[model samples]
Target: MARLTALAGGLAVALVLLAAPAMAHNHPSGITDLVTPAVVRVEATAHVDITLLDHIGELVHVERSYDVPIGSGTGIVINPEGGIVTLTRVVKTDRDVAVYAANRVFAEHHKVKIPADFARHKLKDDVLNHHLQECYPPKTPTATCIINVTTNITVFPNVSPADPKGLKADLVKAGDTLDSPAVLTLSGRVLGSLGMPTAPLADKVPDAAGSPTNVAGFLGRPAPNLPFTVDIAHLRQGGGGDSQGRQFADPEKKVDEPVKLGKLIDEGFLGAPVIGDKDGHVVGMLFGGGQDGRMIGVREITAALAKAGVAPRRGAIDSAFEAALTRYHTKYYTEAASGFQRVLELYPGNVVAAGLLKISLQKRGTAEDAGTKGAVSPTPRSLPLWPFIVAAAVLLVAALVGAFLLWRRRAPEERVEEPPAPVATASPQQPFDEGANPTVVVRRSQPFQVVPRQQPLMTANEQPSVKYCTECGMRLGPAHRFCGYCGHPIET
Candidate 1:
């Protein structure tokens, strides 16, 4: 049993040693990649349809329709059910699209001079001026034009092959301010089943100034050619929970932070999520643009989501991606590759996982990979002594255990117990004749006793007995030649 136990222990150690090389290469990249997959591009437009009434020279009716671009920016998916958070300005515009459509229609049909813009303009002619004035706002009993407007929102996810048509979403809730957070829900039923990757929202903004963070979002339509971008920045002091929002700056001042982030916002980072460097959770969102760029803290973001009645949560796809990401950052490229592949199976078109998978495959067996180190051919100088020493020690322990078990098994057989010898007793016989020699009965344990032939013998029916010492009267055995107690001699 002990030998079996030792062998089992040695086997376990050997297995662990063999597995060490495979696990040695793991190094984790910080939390940046965790939020990238959930970022998406948001585009909104106001579709306007207008009909103009021309009655001055002739009774003529003209109709026109136009799609005016509202705004475009970035947003983060906050739940598996396709809930999203972005700036209100992305989906809800402040400008009057109806007025812009009315201006263009009047200019084209009436041949009237007017700036085709969102601003209301008066005409030189009295009748046309009166008509245009009526079309400016607040529909009343004396209206001259008919207009209708609808807002259309589309979300392009960071995925492979690119979602060309994009997912349709409706504004669930909008914040009080334009730069504040607005919530949207994807329209289709399939979005809930897709297990979309989601960004985790931090409970509140970091209190300390100069907290590190990453701002990740798409610079263009999500595609292989235009992958999402991530930029590092630090939070500046002040504007913790105010409409003014927070500022970003470089502690080292090596780079002009406001200028740099301004360029990013102008390029397409508007409404991007600001991820906290400490834990990789979203601390705020990139708001505003140009030299006046700022961030909206998580406290306001959650308030908007709460108004929308959508709970922010993670899903299974996140589980798989995080597992793969850990292996990837640890430099376990071979194992990392397999893990990423599993993530893609769970959530296809995952841009982050696909990118990491490609890199993992490339680096799996390279010299930098720790997993491949032990498998490489070794030279005399490159060979290590620890492995050999460990093997020798393991063999020595096994031998000792086996020897002990063998000794224990054979101990009982080697110890032999002798049976008690048969006790000898004297039988009645004719006494020795005529004093030739008096036969003496002796025992090993006692003195001998002698009887003369001239003396009378006992009858045949008498009970037989052993001898005793003549002087000491002590009991004796048949082998005794002298009394044990008295030292008396006896003839044999």
Candidate 2:
């Protein structure tokens, strides 16, 4: 029974041991941790020649537009090729693209305009189409606005921004295009000029991730970090709860998904990439602010860029990372931990993976303690010493408890009884002739008498016979009629 108990206890302990490793697995990125790195702050400064009053109140023309900052908004890198997608309102000629990639800020980038189709709203007889050209900047040449234009829709990705790879794109096909309302449509160029009708957007293909069904085919796939959702206030410090930065402000026209948000950002965040909380996938490029803010979805953005002769792809690292993310979402912590470790190995600078791995390790202990979870992997070749120690402790406790109960059960039998008090009696006869009063005496108890096993003595309580001698308390044989000690008389 003792052996069986030990065996059962060890088995239970082993099961308990399995839970620690699982608990140690990595944690998935939460809403805040995932999105912080990918987000970028875009600052565009432009000079517009303006007519202004001089210090003496005389009319004067200023060549530099330094005082007026051209455009301020947000943008996110959409493709590995360095294609940055933002609201078109932020980009203009003479505008400088300053990007804040986390802490590493890049001062200047070539501004490129995304390809979009705009429908110009015009009245009869060619009156001023004031309503249709809202996207066009004030400096856009009037001669180029010969054609009426209205709505603008994102149909393709701008394959080029200032190339982070330091490669300049070769010129492609050039022609006039009325597609964009912001452009001088009649001349197929900005300000009625002829050349590439759009800003140089296509330079090279973005690194494409293989199809979701066939992830293994891709080579050197880039792993996008998991994304998060945070309150607009959390991103900035010391703005009122209700008030936010203009860049993060809600747009006047809110449209549809791909860019749908729980709450609108200030104006600065308008063009920021809306990343998914799950896989860190770019859901859309944010724009618009009506009832529903609009975003260009990943598929549509990439697909349009594909039509526009730009390659769009996801990297292998992204695939692996996303698989790990799936495991984490399903609570397969052990696998997720391994996955996150792999990501860190691939890219040590990946903060999201590191954070997640730390969380996984911390949760593993808790899960193991709860007994509801255990490790998924096989046991290691060498067991940890802790398990053995735990088992030994458990067994020791069991032994101690058993000993205590056994002692309690045998206590009565082991107890010693006081022998009956001795009666007064005359001394052996030393003082009988000296006028001695009856001498009193106390006798010590005799040693316990033992009958050998071979002798086969019956217990006094078991036998009905009065076998003990009443006189002098001597042992008596069953057939004896006389006391053996003190010569006391006895009846058979």
Candidate 3:
């Protein structure tokens, strides 16, 4: 059953946000404050001013009138424009007896015989019935023959009779006469109204643990089961006066339920708001039926408002807060956080929003850090990274250059002079004989390019030229001491 108790709204937020161990017991959130302004203790005073009439239904001289308190009843404002819902009897002054009283006085004023009516009326004057009728006609009737007509209804709101906020409500459509839901509206009216909750409470199955399982997946996020329970209670009093019939309770529902109102509400508290405990939403209204009372659900209240041609709408803060609360239950921590922040912006210092926001932030932080304990922390925004990166790059380039220069510095310094070109040992004075034998031409055995060894102060072309080995037909390298391939002793 949706029978929930009324709690402070802040407490409800805390209950949803706090951990299980930290919140050992349910705390008061004072959520009713949200509904307090909407809820009103209605003290209605109905007055009737009587005048006499003649036998022909013509008005006669005025008779003694009455201006007295009829009764009190509570009512819910369905619209910020003054649309309210209450018992039909509260707003409707059943002056049927007053009608009879006026007629009796008319009979006596005309000096006509009194019919067999249950009540008698005092005579207005000694005028005869027909004479008074002749003297006072419809519009042309004399002032003395005017019909008795006067009724005043005054509604006192949250304040008592002494409070200045007393508002006079007008009867738009009396349920007693229309057989529809009873409704009312105050003079000053209400500035805002609570929007009805559209979603029904789906029956939840509990997991192996006793808590309900959150089977609904909320946009790829883990849905947390709402750990809060609905609180229910009724405001009741015992006294005398015309009592407004209370709303009917669920016939099959058992009494003693926290939400089921078993006691009779005195007439004064009839229309007072029946606030929910946890969310402070109106679970139902305290309506008078008989000895038992029932709260009107959001659906019924909505319907009644519709019938009255008034739409039940939500204010800015209430709308955002409710949306956030819904997201919180589904464990949409990020979205809920944004929603709560929006509400806070709209209504600063909103306790419910603040508490819920803290919860949302905490949950979001935990979700983000779930497995990132060893991960790197984010860099501070105050420092720019580009400068540091550039510095590192410069250091790397300098290190490479330093290594290259150090190798050059460690290179050999002493140069061995080539020994005097080994004497060709007169390739045998045979050369002199060969010269006479034929015009012989000397050519290089191995093709070679001239290579030069240069000091730091010299250029490649300015270095000393290398000579080839005269004995083994091989090219020489810088400072070579022997022929590497031929195993011959090098001259230089």
Candidate 4:
């Protein structure tokens, strides 16, 4: 039980150590990679189909179609089901596409010089100029041109092997302002059942000014040669207001932060997600361009998503990726490899996963791979014989010592049995009985004096036969020197 407890304690410590590296760092070391996979390039095009009516000696009907690119920017996937969040200006344009289409159509059909622009144009001919004015808007029956305009929004994801055609998406919700958050839903087929990778949105913006952040997006269509760009910046004070939008701060003045972001915004990062340095989550979206660049906070993004009836959430791909990331950072390459492989199977061409998986595969089973170390064996080990040997020796010694003690305890109580004592007979001896008889003379002389002399008598009870103990007054055998009942000595 003691060994088991120690083993458990060691395992707990190992787990804590393994998880430490991922939790220790608060800065954005490489966290920008976390959001780059979900970044996508958004392009909006205006499709116009126009019909021109030219009345002349011969009535000719001319129909033509024109594709005009109105807007291009970056966006982020918010959910696994292909829900996207971007700026309204990236998918919706305010220009009069109808007029642009009419201008091109008229120029081609009439073989006349007409500036192909959104503004209304005039012709020297009164009738043609009148027709062009009528084509502007609010269709009238007398108008000489019929035009229909539609916008097509396409999304190119950051994946390998570059999807040349890109996925089709439709605007689901748009904010009040051109730079406000807009929601788009993919109309194309999903890449996988688990859907695409999504960027995590922070619960709230960092309250302090000069908060560090990274802006990630594609400056062009996502491709093998064209990688997503990530730029570091700091947030200015007082973000997310009706008019103040959010501004970038350059404390050191080493670089014009706004101008730097503005240049990227102009290229394609207009709606790029601004990732927070603290936790690598989307705190806001980049907005505006040129000398003054701004951002829209996550609150506005969520609000727009709410209005679109969509919830921002993660999916299976994210779940697998995060699990793998922990193992990778902990140097458990064997386990990490399997986890990364699972992620790749779920979503192929995942750049981060691919890179980590490659490293994991190389490091797996090596000494540094923690997952491969300290593995429990299935077979039980054979215990050493020395302990049992020592135990047996101790038991034998104890038995011998116990036996010797038992013999010593009984030694004093054992006494020898003595032989019986011999009985004694009383006898009298005669004096001078060896010589011849010559003593009769004296006897005659003395006989006359036989006067009355008293003789003492003896009784039968006076015979000397038995002995008694002086201490207890108990009878004793004739040969006994000590009393059997009281252990008293007898004097002869």
Candidate 5:
């Protein structure tokens, strides 16, 4: 019976254990879903070349180029303006610039030619007139018709010169020579000339903490124009002052330790952007260095461009771009590609968006030019409580049924009774019972007596008797307390 009861109890425990995992799976936390859309891969066409220097400190321009295959990083699209703020270093290096658009079209640096016309004026002089001695066609001997070609001519033939459009033109003129600018094409409008600059964090538009940010870039070498997503774990406060007045963290810090952006998005995302998900505004650009990811703030981007005399205006490419990004996060890759293409159609220089759009298209198992369905706002996944409640109810019913069955089975067992044992009487003994019930024969125990042994005292001529403990050879007192050596009591 005991074995049967133990078996039933074990079976009941096993049933409860089997149902726990199902309950937990139905109710996942909300944080898991929130981060899916905010992550992105950053792609950079890294034109890496090594410049060897001569002993005299002059640049020994090695007549060779080390154009490393295109690199990648993660970045965020902060605002609706087509301005995709990423690390300046990513697009600012001494390499040719190319931004892949959503339509799978790589927008490269196309040298444009503008027609220019100039007029040159000059004077022509006739030194001496030669005499026509023979006289050709019937004319007076003194009369002479002189034909002369003037030295003034307006040269208006088609003249086209390749000149960088924006701030770069200002820097590389006759008087001042400046670095080439990073440029992006948005909706056929040139967005920038020099690379984006870094500014102070306090100067940027306020962004709340815990706001969702996305990053897109490259990890290693990606196939030509492939795009991917990067995971952004978190962001923290970081900045420092130096001897060069107030130097903000951006391109300069990239060569040093990996900064905050580097910590979150490391080597692969050398120049990705940290963008605010709320409005798709680029908040920070990634820099590769430091244990943690490093990035420069958006304010720095605006300030740097401003210093170069380039005013960045918000474009219409942001909404569609974000919509596509949202689709990609939701695993709606097909729709995402379409959204990215739409953004590219409006803004050409959005490299990050263009790269991702192409990837989203590829993920959907479709070609880059394939049509996709329109996207609607997704319904948030709700906590599933009914399944857990039903499971609990079933468990409670099973336990109650088990208890009822057990009680019923125990009720059928019969009770048993046992008879009590009889007491025995003792026989009486006959003695002087005739007189007074015979004074019961009494018996008494005798007291024990011990014999004492006596020892003779030593005379003056003989040595006094001395007692010693057998255990440790210590002397004992005549009245003998306990032996000091082994704590044995001595007889008096």
Candidate 6:
């Protein structure tokens, strides 16, 4: 009983020890909870000029259109006017920029003229046709429509200015130093852009000082989206040069170190938000393909946007924008376009959703045209079923034949062959008289018998038992009353 009790106690202790680590590992951190809401997928469609260097030392420039998609990157809603504060690199464009708000609302160019006949046809199908008819004109046989046209595109959120409490505005009448970072508010919540509270190096930094930092970004072409991230070892102050200056000056150099983001958040976290450890504020964006992983600070992001003469704006259309984005991800382009259009109706200045909406509308239009064409097309004739039936019949006949042949080959040999009868020899010739019946004499063979020959009788002084049987010279049984073969009796 004592041994059993000790064994049970040990097992209980072991189980408790095993469960402790799992509970700790599964506990969600403050950073993950805080930044998940602000994370948004930035989807862009742009024409990238590809330059190829051939073996012959000739450079070929190819202008190809590509859809760029960035998923689950950290972003901030700066204001109620639908302005979003995200990494400029996240929305950078050689040709165009489109934003997919957290609510899935799309901001894109919507000023295209819609033909009367096309609009009427689309409206006949559904109210959602407005999105398609407005952006893509039906192609006429006489005049081919150019589907891919290079347009200067910009996107912004439609944030209403009336929300007093959420609105954050820097009150600079005419001449203010504007030394500190600007703060904006939306829905009465004060918002800060990437550059707001810059991260500074702490004291007592080690000689070989570098801390793990997460970088997230979108990879591959946008049509089929691929998102990924990398962890980088952020160096101390003046260790690997300033994070701000080094990133822009040498984007290639930062791609050379292996990033260790601890075991908890490692691979498959591409395009994940990287938040500040102190306040859980988003401070950087990550891109894949760097040895240590590529990351750009908030300062660099804001600076890039300033260069492009654009600022982050979040507005009333944000909810609708996010909804459209969700629809797009779900592959409901029709619904997505409607959602994007609702956003546009609310905020006409949102270029991100406007551009994406144009593409979505075009896709929807083409799909409708294809569907109509398929409906009008003739049904093809199917081949006769007789061929299959005939083949099956032939196979059945062949199987029957094979079975019969197999049975014939395996038949018993005794059943197939019979032995010949023996011929009889003529008896002694006794047929001299032809008239009288001939009588033939036959000799019978002697029966097999054991006859005992006479043997000398033993005297009283001698043994009475016989040494062996006289007929067959065989030994007698131990307690035999008579010989087994000839009936000769023997004394015990």
- Model 5 TM-score on a 0 to 1 scale: 0.31
- TM-score-based ranking, best first? 1, 4, 3, 2, 5, 6
Total backbone collisions, model 2: 48
Best of the two (3, 5) by TM-score:
3
- What is the C-alpha lDDT profile of model 2 across 1-492, one tens digit per residue? 455557666766776676555445444432333333233334433322322212223333322122234443444433334334444454332322111110011001112222222222233322222322322333344321122211211111111121122212211111121110011011111111111111112222122221110000001112233122233211111222111211122222333321333234333445555444334344444544443344434444444454446444444445556666566655556777888888666544454567677777665545422222564433343245566667666776776677668778986766444333223343342212222111112223444443321222445554434455576665544434454333344554
lDDT of 2 at 419: 35
Tell me each candidate's TM-score: 0.70, 0.33, 0.39, 0.70, 0.31, 0.26
| Residues 311-333, model 3: lDDT tens digits | 55446555676777666655557
Deviation of model 1 at 239, angstroms: 2.7
lDDT of each: 0.78, 0.36, 0.44, 0.78, 0.37, 0.36
List clash counts for every candidate, in order: 13, 48, 29, 0, 59, 55
- Model 3: how far residue 69 lies from native, Å: 4.2
Q: Supply the TM-score for candidate 1.
A: 0.70
Query: Candidate 1, residues 1-492: lDDT per residue as tens digits?
Result: 566666756775775566465445333334778888899999999988777776778777778899999989899999998999999988888899988988898888778789888998988898888888776666777766788888999999888879899999999998888888999999864332556899988888776778778889888888778888888888897674567889988888887777788788888888999998777889999887877678999888888898889999999989878878877776668888999999888888888899899999998988645457654643322345467557757776777778778889987766533333223333546342233223343444455544432333556775644676677666554545665444565445
For 1-492, candidate 4 gives per-residue lDDT tens digits of 344445545555565555454335233243775688789999999999888787744777889999999889999999998999999999888888898888888888778899989888889998778767876776898877888888899999887778899999999998898889899999988787789999888998887888889999888988778888888999888765756788898777788999999999999999999999888899999889987788898998999999999899999999888778777766668888999899889998887788789999997887666666453421122233445445555555565666667777875555333333333232232122212111111232244332221222225554434566788666555445665444567768
Distance from true location, Cα of 87 in model 6, Å: 4.8
Q: Which residue segments of model 4 deviate by more than 4 Å?
A: 1-30, 362-492
Which pairs, if any, clash in model 4? none
The whole-model C-alpha lDDT of candidate 4 against the native structure comes to 0.78
- Give the TM-score comparing model 3 with the true structure, all chains together: 0.39
Residue 308 Cα positional deviation in candidate 3, in Å, after optimal superposition: 1.6
* Candidate 3 Cα lDDT to native: 0.44
List runs of model 1 lying over 4 Å from the truth: 1-29, 189-193, 238-240, 372-492
The TM-score of predicted model 2 comes to 0.33
Off by over 4 Å in 2: 1-39, 47-68, 93-263, 273-283, 290-292, 297-300, 368-492
